[model samples]
Target: MSKRHISLKDLANELKVSISTVSRALKNHPDISPELTLKIQKLAADWNYTPNPLAMGLLRQQTKMIGVIVPDIVTHFYASIISGIEEVAKQHGYYIVIASSNESLQKEIESVENLLKSRVEGFIVCLSQETNKYDHFEKLNSNEIPLVFFDRICESLDVPSVVVDGVEATKKITRHFYENGCKRIAYISGPEHLNISKNRKVGYLEGLKECGLKFDPQFLVTCNLSTKDATRATRQLLTNKILPDAIFGLNDTIAFAAMKEIKNQGLKIPDDIALVGFTDEFHSTVVEPSLTSVTHPTFKMGQEAANLFFKCIRNGKGFSEKIELKADLIIRESTLK
Candidate 1:
């Protein structure tokens, strides 16, 4: 047989006090005498009483639970971000519920609907690859529910967001390749609809201009950000009559695929074709030649997003805030001669 868990009602009955009195005493409310509070604390300790979050939230009209939605949870970047969010949430006596959209617009919409049904007090999100329309997020804003975005965000929407400067980060990487004596630089990009992709492309062009390298139309290739797609893009670039001396992928995942394909084509890294990628993923170090890439402040970005959501909640209204964090360039064997 199992012992029954103690509740406030049970405590009140044992102490011969009202349920409200027991609640106040347990919380150390000012109205409750110190002696009574101490008595309640001792009894609570003896019974191993733990206040139910759901019951307490009902009384306060707050769930004390923040909802987090990301493109993919399996990615280490997003996982680190979630860690940062959880750290700050625990400090504020709040918890979080997480959902992954798998880069699909429909899944993102469903996640939003389901989290709302759970009565989450706020939301932190990173938009999906196919999330161009802002209707679902707009609805959350219309209802005055506090929401914050991180990383891949919707620029058209008026909301608080935390992101790194994609343009500057990519520009630095492109310049690094030029300094390594790469006359021709090629960039493998993702879908045009993604803001990160657009910003990175712009940066690549600007970096070329700075290096006195002419932009070649044939050097730019777009793919779906999948490994297979990236491999195809790399093969296409390799087949060009004038092959690029260097290749840059929008992210490490694509870059890894590009590296594999480049090797398969009998090219030596840096000696034949220098390679660079963004978002310094964990696998970058374990590859045949360590990848040179841009390091995103993913954990800090998550903390800022959650902090922004809390700020909105305290203010009782949304005020647009755009917080941009800096990214670092990490040079590795892949880019070294």
Candidate 2:
């Protein structure tokens, strides 16, 4: 081989600076001092370094790449949404760079910064469960970056977003439980800080009131949306003096954990304890006493987010919109009794 190709990363490593800094120096951005810019330029010339053709194209016109960030990438929930986003993006002559926060706030921030360095034209994000502070997102807005949020979003930010009607979905679940003669219904919720938890709780309370049932504090419990924490929450309700006749969880993971715990305690689903869950995950049908759940329009939600992101790019800063999609309850054996 004559010589190995030198990429921006390699140049950054040699210069002991960030990739973004090196990139700015190469572009002769005003932010980079003249002395440092000259040094970087001379180094690149001596090394015969050339930028990626695609990156050069992006500098000439647009990156044609959209950054997508989600709490987790392995879930069916996210996979479908990403498919939809890609479908819409490809139709518009754009591609996507996906990043997983893995449900960590710090990782979410890192993903944003890294994507920015890549110079993606826009971003579509779903908030991680641990994202209580929204400064990272706010920074994106302050810089006039085209940003859109889906599913779990930060309401404090004025960015465009797409979400399922969690309040209405939970209300439907509560109504189903009440219609099935479940008086003392319980809800296992996620963290209080999450928008999903707050909206669902509101619906649960409103549904109880609509059905002429008292909102019993004992029947409500919060978990961190982990299997272990969900199991603990379920156990807490089960051991109560007056056990709830029906139970629903924030998502299928929580519902699955609750189902296992309920079985371990010798409770019959829908007979002694009706069960329902959100997200309508794949295993919802395969599980014994097949779970009833809310099926979100996930693909549509993603398409809408991507569509909204393009709109934001065209509209520039101070443009905001919120799209709330509907979800339907899938009746199954778990709540039929």
Candidate 3:
């Protein structure tokens, strides 16, 4: 049978000392005699001994592990953000525990509980689309856990957050549409409760006013950010008495759905109706008539969120700040007209 790795107890027994003494000696604690420290160090080296991270963490009450939550992990958007977060985490000798809410509030709550049980030192989160309540997060805030949010976040909470200026991005898209000679511009928004939808709607209205165009309630519609809902919204807009000459979807998923629905109705893109989307996904380039979209600084947003989390850890309780990043409108074939 293969030999088992020796434990601290074995080392203590062999050296005729207590386990605590062996541990302190290995650490070269000043309280340990120089001779005993050398002996313990040599024995540890010869035995190929290593301290257990989990055990040490329990002893010191420092996990050095951060919990991270996002809407979903399949998209390049969240993946890129995770990469950036990991980069920062490694620099600080910390690890991240990731969880996906999958756009469900219940799942988000469960994830929070599970990560807390894991004893993660802190959390970095992007609220799910369906997360309308803040009670689950409020508990962490009340307990003074190191927490930072990114992208979709709770603005009411006194927690640090990193996000893009959706308002300005949408405004840019609207102005681009107007400059392209589209008068009846429409915007497809997400749920009313989402901060993203609210911010973009503000920008859309501002853009319309800036272009000297009156706001038409019929031109704006809401979707659940799903393909079917987006397609239905698109159909509703198309069937209006005065059809929109341009359309902007809250995200690529919505835009792709709108594209299909528009094609189904025999409408020519950038001819009968121009289109744009937010979150420039990779598929945007490969799709026929490449979609115009808002390119967010996802990686940077991740880095900022991680940095903010560490800052909160250092500053201790009741610390909060907000960081806003900028996004650019990538004009493409779909909006060229």
Candidate 4:
């Protein structure tokens, strides 16, 4: 017989013992006799018997595996978050399966479906830029699977989430520009569909009001959160009849692109146009005139999201939890006059 055909049932049949007895013997359970245990262990080793975690999970109705989906894994922000998730998961004796969506909604849906078929106990996800609908996620809720969203989340869902207060964070950054003597602040925002973008815009408006600055429709430009798009937006803003004294990018990548464009136009940092970005990525410090940015606790967000998932698992149902983490502004040469 092929080794591939070897199984617990095969061992039980050969030894003329019940399947449960064979299983218990293999595990060295106290109820199994020492002789039987030794015999089963030897036979299993001889047969090269391998346990199947999926089958075992099905039998117990609990898989010690988790599924994590992020927009992109190459970015340090997401990588840091995944590291935190893995750290906490190891302590809880759970394994994580990671997938990157590359900001594609189709890929994100496919990954979720594949992980579901693999029988992961729970999920931690950050919505893809193109994912405006929540149907795929709703299916998980209907199946009673525990889920937690972080960073980019679907506000329509009642699921637990771990995220920073985007509005407050942006408000602080905007206020910083005003304090630094910026007369008109321009904001390069992301796609309107994203909740983070909307919240940040609100904060930006509030900050302008707080600073007694008028809202200029021309100052707010939307992009697809790409470097090329941000560069173009910056060019458009700089060409405006009324020049902005400061500019804020929705995220670090966009900010970096904008900074490059500003320099390309022979503009001086802080002196001509103060700049700030969200998500204090690694490049924020390395770039010339080091980028001023909002520092997100990405690792802590991941840890908290995983903790919330386990909490939902223990509760045996989907319960609502909203965990708001802190994001602080880091001043640098880019925004300092």
Q: Rate the local accuracy (lDDT) of all candidates.
A: 0.87, 0.90, 0.89, 0.88
Clashing pairs in 3: none
Q: Model 4: runs farther than 4 Å from truth?
A: 1-60
- Pairs with steric clashes in candidate 4: none
Residues 214-309, model 2: lDDT tens digits: 999999999998899999999999999999999999999999999999999998997999999999888998999899999999999999999999
Candidate 3 on 1-337: residue-level lDDT in tens?
A: 1134457887898889999999998877999999999998888777655454223334247778999999999888899999999999999999999999999999999998788778788789999999999977875676567889998899889899998999899889999999999999999999899889999999999999999999999999999988899999999999999999999999999999999999999999989999998999999998888999999998998899999988997888778989999999888999886
| The candidate that achieves the highest lDDT relative to the unseen native structure | 2
lDDT of 1 at 108: 98
Best by TM-score: 2
TM-score of each: 0.81, 0.83, 0.82, 0.82
Instruction: Give the higher-lDDT candidate: 1 or 2.
Output: 2
Model 4 Cα lDDT, one tens digit per residue, 215-296? 9999999998888999999999999999999999999999999999999999999899999999999999999999999999
Model 3 lDDT at residue 46: 74
lDDT of 3 at 112: 88
